[model samples]
Target: MTTRTLTPETSNTFTSTIGGYTVRGRAHSLSAWFVLSLRLMMGWAFAYSGLTKLLAAEPFSAGGYLTHVAAANGNPLAGTFAWMGSTPWFVEFANVAVLWGELFIGLGLLVGAFVRLAAFFGAFMMLMFYFGNWSIEHGVINGDFAYMLVFLAVAAFGAGRILGLDTYIENYEVGGRTLVERYPALEYVLG
Candidate 1:
């Protein structure tokens, strides 16, 4: 049998078989799959929740939720939601905003579009949900906290560029300055 020596170029890659399928490529880090899973799961959750609220059989209103929050004695944000519920115009605005926000966040993550922006908003929204009358009796922390961290991670890693539209947008330059150059701070937050 003859053996071949791998050069530097060839050394960069390796092959492995799993479930009888041969996979050949550069090594994949755990973070790659972790981000992908987070994106899909978070995206699906927000999209499904938003769609349900939007297409509910009965007319959906934020007033009821806000009103309930207003009555939640142990919830720190009860007063805030209560005040919001007290204002008809603000209530209407919030109702539309929350539903649309969820839908947009989901779409952004799923399609890997404007992921940084989406994740920023998603983090804050999750924070609001967590503090917005969630019963302390249930637990001090909950799923929203976990989701918030995932959103932050996505933003920090610019995870969208992996398999999303951000990959295309990342290379676009305007007036001799790439988008990242113009918004250097965004480099860490977006691709």
Candidate 2:
């Protein structure tokens, strides 16, 4: 492993091997800004999409799309999608979950609160969309897959620590110790 300080206050180092070839590098500190930008962009996209659906005159329904579109897409998960569509309760639940879930995920990311949790759900939703949309005329890689990866990257990098509320939340005092110090498990959810 190679280690080097990229900035006065921080060191970024990474190493990986693929097909017996090892690669190593250090990320510039400026990379944080790009990560922040990605968080904000994805937040806005999901927020806008959910808000539009919530404000529409007609209620959002996923039954038709799930049954007709996804089921007919010749995707690997078409049967699972069809099952979800055929189940009335699951369809109803999905309709509400998709809309509210997007809004909540967006709001969490925008404010940098519970960002890991939000990014997890965001990635899951994107995975579903990726499988559902299954337009592989070019290849299996699509925008949804890419977005899912971005969400995972955000979570893995703990992007919430960059000018986000998670910093404050993590440091909050409960009794005499900081919240994260008191409950280390929170590290999974917060930066």
Candidate 2's displacement at residue 127, Å, is: 0.3
Clashes of each: 0, 0
- Residues 18-104, candidate 2: write the lDDT tens digits: 999999877787889988988888888988889999999999998987887776778999998999999999999999999999998
| Top-scoring candidate (TM-score) | 2
Q: Candidate 2 clashing pairs? A: none
Q: Which stretches of candidate 1 lie over 4 Å from their true place?
A: 1-28, 183-189
Which candidate tops lDDT?
A: 2
The TM-score obtained by model 2 is 0.89
What is the TM-score of each predicted model, taking all chains together?
A: 0.77, 0.89
CA-lDDT, candidates in order: 0.80, 0.89
Q: List residue ranges in candidate 2 displaced over 4 A.
A: 1-10, 14-24
